[model samples]
Target: MGETSDDGRLGLFGAVSISVGGMIGGGVFAVLGVVATIAGAASWAAFTLASLVSLCVAYSYLKLNAMGDNRGGSVSQLEEYLDDASVAGMVGWTLLVGYVGAMAMYAYAFGSFSVALTPPSLVDAVPLGEGLLRPVFSVLAVVLFVVLNVLGARATGLSEEVLVVAKVAVLLAFGGLGLWYGVQQGSMEYGFEQIRSVTPVVMATAVSFVSFQGWQLLMYDQDSIRDVETTLPRAIYASILITILVDGLIAVVVTSLAAPDVIQQHPERALALAVEPVVGGIGFTVVAVAALFSTGSAINGTLFSAANFAKGMVGDGLLPDETGRASADGAPQRTVLLLGVVAAVFTAYGSLDAITSFGSLAFMSVFGAMCALAVSERDHESVHPLPPAVGAVGCAAFAVLLGVHLWNAERGTFWAVLLLAVAVHAVELLYFERESIVDGVEHAEDLLVPGSG
Candidate 1:
């Protein structure tokens, strides 16, 4: 964690920016249309519900952070309290995979928006056709960021603050202008009428939960924060509240500006398309550019964090030492490269919906597990069981809802997510119990040597 200030400490505003930046990343740009498609006129409701879940989860995180002196984040907390390295490693792996999913989604959005903004003549001149263009651009974006990270060029402190502020400003401006246009055109009523059925809204909430996972990144940067007990909680809560407002507002404005079918048709570029009618080409350009910047920055930030996390896990003996190897400039080049390659594969092959679903489910699982850990610490004087208990139950219900929704609508994606989860846990188990398994194999081999017996 690079210091954001001369004193190597973060103030309230800086802390809030980190949380806000984390939450506001490419998530809304990538997942907004999916939410609108599922929740329709009730997209705002879905975002609200999702934020409530995030709030509960955030409470558990805050409590857990306060209970510990180590700034090693969730993995450390899990190992410390549960006294089980295996469980911690599994959760840590899931968290890392989730971050990769997020990077893929961001890259996907960046490519989609960039391609959408390209001239039709140029696109038609290309031999690869439209289908391959997005993936090509996505992979290129991933490679670019990976190279940047390897070169130790990153947005930190003031630059990061400026980037986040610009992102929020763009989003708020688009939402506000779109809302006004909808009102002038008498489209607000139609938008209000689209809010039908609670099931789809709840399902949308499940899908949208990934957009809120960024707030948890703050847990890993506790060392850079000043007055962890006072500033951290306030920053976390304020950031979430602000994100909820922004997400809900955008949902309403988008639903108002465009029909569900329209958004579904171009889920990746929904925001730009939604505002094109009222603001014309200029509006589309602005939104598309914003999406590009937002997603690009997201890829950079997430890649950096995930690489450092892998290095940290290596230090803790949870991962192979090779992953922790740093460059002469002190960058985790290998981990960054590894993560970037995997994220590129995901971007090149996975759909926005599937990637979003997988990411949301992964984070929800980890958050639920963390809440369960919090629940187990009920004896702590400062730890209240009710908040974390509710969080655990809510996360469980949302995860089930996500599974049911995916199974019913996209069975292939559902299997992919499940298979990925199973594979991660299996690898964790194999890595942890390798010695015992090796010993068992040797015993069997000895028994087979009848002459020696």
Candidate 2:
């Protein structure tokens, strides 16, 4: 780990890596099929749209970070700005649920991609169907990562390089081969009319926003980064630009080279299937391995961070005190174990499409709310009016589109996640009613009394 004072040791390279690594995980491989089903040959356009929205969200985060020295993310923002403990608790719980859902999706992706590599003997030995084994494997992956986290295993720079570089290199290679194949086969012009509707385009953009989630990770490192004002924005812009180019190329290549039915049928393995036209059977192994690495690394990092996040929430009285308990090794073992179990259960029960949808909506809603808060505050002298305005409006629009997509396509999952969010907040209210009320009053007093904190 890089040592630093209150200010960070990370430079532009570190910031960019954080942005890219946070994104470009199981999301690209898993959500590609979903977007492909929605936008067909124009999936690249969906990515472009999502990139625009990500840029806007990044703007809001950067603006907020520029105004403060603290590194706390949404929870901090809600408490400091909104000054309402109930709101912060609700948003914090929602964010936690979203992270868990994403973790489940990553676990599911790991297991699904590992299917091709599973030994035939092992596969045959299973009494249940092949599809049934995925959940088991998914649960195992979550448990394994949880144990590793409890052991204080962290993704060092070398590990990050191996994980992020290898996956990006391989995916870029696939994109190159697929692009060449598309050009030679003249499939680029094969399906223009299929991109007729706006609803699907907006929906695809919203879901694919998950692929850009990591860009905001840099925001949390604000205190550490050198030249916070200039470096932060530059890194955010550059990382998003790189992601846009890479993801756009991959989307275009996949939609051009593969059949829509094939992608839809195997959304989790769509990239693997898309690569077959270029490199044949071995290509599947290549993409599948990349998926495993991507999802594995993502699970490790998110699991470690989520455990700490749970502890932070407990410190703020947002969660039950038991969640913040540490084991003998000084790990947030309780939260880690609980998160692993919840993620495992989600993997077993939830579909990728449903999980991705719920995660996307939760993140988008959080970003939108943050942007709205920034706009309402309007105290930051450095921030311009346009970016926050655009971010707030864009986030709201995309969130609505996402909601419509859920209502139209995954209505059952939509309602289930909705009730799940309410249930989470309901528990928060029942368990922490006094704290919530007290915190809210104190927050209001702090705002009114000026320097009371």
Candidate 3:
């Protein structure tokens, strides 16, 4: 077993904040409306089901972290256990693309909320080109964060702390007020009545899975945490449990406040409408502003984590070395820039459903891979076969959900995401092979020379 040497940086609270911040980002506010269309008022139930699946996946991650040298998270675990550079590279690549899709989703949410708040006169006042408002602002949000990250790590961390606290506070207040109103109207029964068949709820789980993406962020902090063994599992459980409760309550509150049809039509602005009856226009404004902050914080946190992940891949020699270069501020400038540009392009063009599917599937696949790894290595001393086995089954259940979604929907973008993933692995195998061989030859030479030079 290994121990953690704390540099007095992140305590239990800090760790929780990182995970919560990453998970809560634009997900609830942005995707809730879409989920409403799927799961009806049972959207909260969908959130609960998705949380269960994510919890199962988290079990595999905790086990993997305990057994291995405390270094990287999922990607590291894959590299160690799978022992295949091409496989690890594919996982890493999918993760990179997933983060990009997520950032684009957040950016899209930011633009949608920002545009909703804009005055009609002001929108018309801008005599600029057509279809430029949301896309322009979305790209601008990406650019702003890229610059913020390039400023340095300290600034980024501090911003996340502030944003996390603020957004959570706003959500708590909103949830409390909405809960009070629901009680007054006895809306719980109505919410229950909205529940339909199992298939829509399952599909909703697949889409809403994006909201829980932040739990993996905790894995990235294994090295910095104070107590590696105890603190890691406790922090992850606490954050996820708390998120599930909070998210469930909020989902119930929103559904109680507004009809499913209303939320579906205004998915982007549903939160504002949910609290409008209780708090009036001020409530709408509050929820809207909170969403803006929520989406922005999500973008910021993802950029920070995604850049670090890319840099780690560079360290592992999975990616081209140049993309990992640091700038004056010690940020992975190249990777950050690349991610920003890609997110910008996606934000500018991709629809919300497309972005959500891409991000959700990418993460769902990663969780599935982790579970499979656990099952494969269950014979290890620290590993158990059951939870990983169960987790693998849970992941497969969600994959079925994805498949159903594709079959019912248009299927064009689904095919694209699948093709893109296949292409990434194929290219990684061909292009990355030469570098792996050179690395192997160099290692062998060093072993043979033994400082002879």
Candidate 4:
């Protein structure tokens, strides 16, 4: 059933939908309020900056993918070029964690928008307060998607195509109508006047980097894509460019529709609230519904990708082989459940900003490493080193800014993220040295048992 001929593979439209769907799925909806709070009227500029860096990284991916037919994403690329299984394993771990964080962000947005849409009386009647309900709903969403993934219900083929079209249409409509309304009311000019300083914009760019990461998912699905050489590049570039415009438009329109303080106060439901001025209660409902759909799709798509990624890692000997066991249909049920549980924990404990920051930082680190690899391997005539060099430097700089922003604004989250990173690396190290570790454990058991050996 997994076998497919070239005629059955995805074309340019499908490939573009995958990339666009990945990027626009939940990022813009979840991070709008955070960006508005940080960059004020300059939020669009921050998105633009982040898109530029994403473009650079996309270039690196394009070049690297051209060099080989293997499709393990960054791990495969690193293993092939650097020839270091350890580094590849470490990056794969980080990328997997980053995907989990992304799913957490999606679940958070889904829960937030869902809760925002409920009637007040209904919400009030619940035993749990609104604060607790959000996470409860978030965890439930994760469970639902995990179940779906295990059942082999994916957001690909025609399903993904429809979702991409509907999502882009809804977002474009909101942005366009909001912008028109703002201009009609002179709010657009006023909003422009309220733009923040450069530092905040830079910080916002770093915070918003995760939104631009969906395109990277395409790298993992290379086999399903037709004409991988030509179509892949076109689809990746087109999707990112489209996402950039969509993101910028939404940021401008949202900031113009509401004040920064107003958005900050309701970061999770910022889009719903921001659009309320343009179309009354209907706008709120529309945005909330859109968010639910977007976030739901994002969760399903990412969960599936992450599960497959875990399975691939196991195949590569990066993860415990037991985790690679799959269902009859070849679904990595164990890893799917594992990723879902971790994502639920993240959603339950982490704030939107914290999750976004961690996810963005994790991806930035991976992208930077990839870009550095591209630069290091520039001896090939087809690879130009300049763009990747810029990408590496840009990602490094933004990662630092993200750290500073988090340390100053959310010190607790900063420490939590740092601890998580350290833990991921430690796990990677131990996994690589598992044989020695096993031997040491056996020796300890022999000593303790006094002749068991």
lDDT of 3: 0.78
RMSD of 2: 6.1
Q: Which stretches of candidate 3 lie over 4 Å from their true place?
A: 1-7, 126-131, 153-159, 189-196, 326-329, 433-453
Indicate whether candidate 2 or candidate 4 has the larger TM-score.
4
- Candidate 1 lDDT by residue in tens digits, 198-296: 688889889999999887877877778888779889989999999988988887778788877889888878788888998899999988898888888
- The Cα error of candidate 4 at residue 148, in Å, is 0.8
Best of the candidates, TM-score: 1
- In order, what lDDT does every prediction score? 0.84, 0.77, 0.78, 0.85
lDDT of 2 at 294: 87
Q: Write one digit per residue (lDDT tens) for candidate 3, span 168-207.
A: 8888889888998889977753335545567777888888
Model 2 residue 13 lDDT score: 70
Report the Cα lDDT for residue 267, model 1. Answer: 86
Worst 10 residues of 4 by lDDT: 189-198
Candidate 4, residue 347: the lDDT equals: 97
Candidate 2: clashing residue pairs, number: 1
